[model samples]
Target: MNAPDDTLEFTGGLVARLPEPADFGIALAEGFARRIGDLSRRAGAPAAAARWAARAAFAA
Candidate 1:
């Protein structure tokens, strides 16, 4: 479903005003979390991988 115009405008403006350093920190953390998930999957640890992926999605 499409967001209402005012809601879209407010969210778009909010995102546009976020600090660059915060974005960089989030990207770095997300990349590290995803890498952990990948390694866990490669090591045949599905439970660990799933947990890491969930953490990444929740935290990031």
Candidate 2:
């Protein structure tokens, strides 16, 4: 993926494409929302999906 202007360029051609510092929460929330939605469909439980997503997000 192409890195945005504000993102940091790392070694080994890996790019970290993060939103602005002010928008970090919004970005993280959006990702969590999407992941929860996907996991809910597969797991059939919103609470479990959210728990799994929370763990994964925290680990990341």
Candidate 3:
């Protein structure tokens, strides 16, 4: 995914935008979450899917 071009203006007039590295990290985390959730459900642990998905995402 492409990083947004929008910038945040600070009190001192400093402009900040989402860095490419951070954007990629966020995308990866999202992918991990989805995959973990799917795997958990497929293993017949739907009840714990959300919890495990969260753990996997953060542990990455």
What digit string (tens of lDDT, one per residue) describes model 2 on residues 1-60? Answer: 343353211112223434456355544554554565567657776766656664455345
For candidate 3, lDDT tens digit of each residue in 1-49?
A: 5533421111111122346566566545555655666677777786566
Give the TM-score comparing model 1 with the true structure, all chains together.
0.50
Better of 1 and 2 by TM-score: 1
Better of 1 and 3 by lDDT: 3
> Residue 47: error of model 3 in Å?
3.5
Global Cα RMSD, each model: 9.5, 11.0, 9.2
Clashes of each: 0, 0, 0
Q: What lDDT would candidate 3 get against the real structure? A: 0.50
The superposed Cα distance between candidate 1 and the true structure at residue 2, in angstroms, equals 22
Task: For each candidate in the order shown, give its overall lDDT on alpha carbons.
Answer: 0.49, 0.47, 0.50
Question: Alpha carbon lDDT of residue 58, candidate 3?
Answer: 42
- Hey, what RMSD does candidate 2 come out at? 11.0
Q: How many clashes in candidate 2? A: 0
TM-score of each: 0.50, 0.38, 0.50
lDDT of candidate model 2 versus the reference:
0.47
User: For model 1, which pairs clash?
Assistant: none
